[model samples]
Target: MTLLEQLGIKHPFLLAPMAGVSTPELAAEVSNQGGLGSLGLGASTASSAREQILKTQELTDQPFQVNFFCHQPAVLDAQIAQQWIDYLSPQFQKYGATPPEQLNCIYPSFLDNDDFLNVVLETQPKAVSFHFGIPHAHQIQALKAAGILTLVSATNLAEALAIEAAGIDVIIAQGIEAGGHRGIFNETFDSSVRTADLVQLIKKHCQLPIVAAGGIMTGQQAKVLLNLGADALQLGTAFVQCKSSNANIAYRKALFDQPITQITASISGRPARGLINHWHMQIDTPERPQVPAYPYTYDLGKQLHAAAVQHNDHGFGAFWAGSNVAQIRELEAADLINQLVLEMNFA
Candidate 1:
């Protein structure tokens, strides 16, 4: 069967499940319009994730997917955490605040426990996708038995091979240009493959369907990946501007006014691509110490951002977007999907 057929969607489009930015309305709108809608529940509690899943189901009967972070549970080092806190203390001081002494693990990985797995099985979304790494074997088996499609983001061939070996039904080829967290299974290394190249590489070796993600802001770009052997296209930055998306005023404005993007591990500890701002220009200096770790460094980053916001400095916000954010348009979710279909057909 075709990838779209397996996905139970009419179009070969999937909204990139963007944590913090995804909304039930946005997910439903995409699914209602014939593409796969998605929820980024990596940051949500199982109860909250359930609520979001049920709300999306109420809004649309069409198939949709929900996603969670599959990162290995973060291991915080005291010395490193203290250094990171001390380094950012000055920035906090500028806003008349102080960094917290203990950095909390703000997000729980799907692999850390069975909470997220239970949510997926209970809600039974058409698909469940993961990032940073793959779910445990038992989690994968349970998901497969539940009849929900499984997808995982793979940055390079090794990760792709692992995902395939783990019995994931589909692969999300997250190019280096992707916004948000890079889905490198190993935190310390990234092969840095681009979207088109990654698609070709995976298709040549892996038998599973490929979903091209990252830096895809236009239908022509989506078509290019499709030609390169991607079975479907996933767009995150392209949908962040939708009215239903949870993006704030500052984030929306920056997407249009400042389109340049760069990857930094400063914001969330794990490296993610977002529009260049203070984190890129001021904080990520040559003398910057090694960041503590995922989620822990994110704790400090969030605190500093909160303080900066109080002082009316929105540059500290996490305004994530793909490298091709310059090509972003001002369309709503359904309209954007329609426009993309037209563009893809013509392209």
Candidate 2:
């Protein structure tokens, strides 16, 4: 069966499962329009993730995918955590707030435990995709036994080969231009390949279906990747402007006003591309210290953002967007999917 047939969708479009921004309404809208919809469950607890999955099931019977983070669990180094906190404490004080005494691991990795795996089996979405790394052997075995397709993000040929070797159903070729997290399994290294090039590179060596992601804002761009052998296209920044998304007013405004984006590891202890803001201009400096581990550093970043928001400083927010955010349009999910289909055909 073709990728579209496996996904149970008419159009070869998939909504990038943006964690904070994806909503049930948006997912349903896209799926209703014959495009595969998605929910980013990496940030949610198992219970909350199940709730969102059930809610989306009620909203539409059409097929959609749920995503989870698969980063290796890291032990927090207190000294390093304290140093990162110390560096950002001045900014906290500027807002008349003190930073947290200690940072907590706000998000859990799928590899950390079977909590997420159990949730996926229970909720049983059409498919499940992972980022940062691939799932464990037992996790993959259970998912396949349940008859759910598994997908994983691949940033380079090595990661693609690893995913193929592990028996993942599809490979999401996440380019360096991808807006959110870099999805490089090893945080220490990233090949930083672009979308079109990565698609062809992986297609040449890997047998899995390739889903092109990153910096795809228009159907013309989507067509380019498809022509280069991408089995499907997944876009995040384009659908962020939809009404059903959870992006705040400030984030939505910034998407248009400041289309320029930069990648920084300071916010989440992982390199993710987003609109240029304080994180890029002020925090990520030449003299900055090495950040703490993945979710540990994210804890402090959230607190500082909350404190800044009380003072109307939205610049501290995690306003993630792809490199092609400048081409974003303000359209509802259904309308945007329809427009992409139209443009894809004409292109």
Index of the highest-lDDT prediction: 2
lDDT accuracy of residue 74 in candidate 2: 91
Tens-place lDDT per residue, model 1, 263-337, is 999988888999999999999999998898898888788888889998889988889999999999999999999
TM-score of each prediction: 0.99, 0.99
lDDT for position 284 in model 2: 90
lDDT per residue for candidate 2 within 135-204, as digits (tens), equals 9999999999999999999999999999999999999999999998999999989999999999999999
Worst 10 residues of 2 by lDDT: 329-338
- Candidate 1 local lDDT, residue 23: 97
Model 2 clash pairs are none
Which pairs clash inside model 1?
none
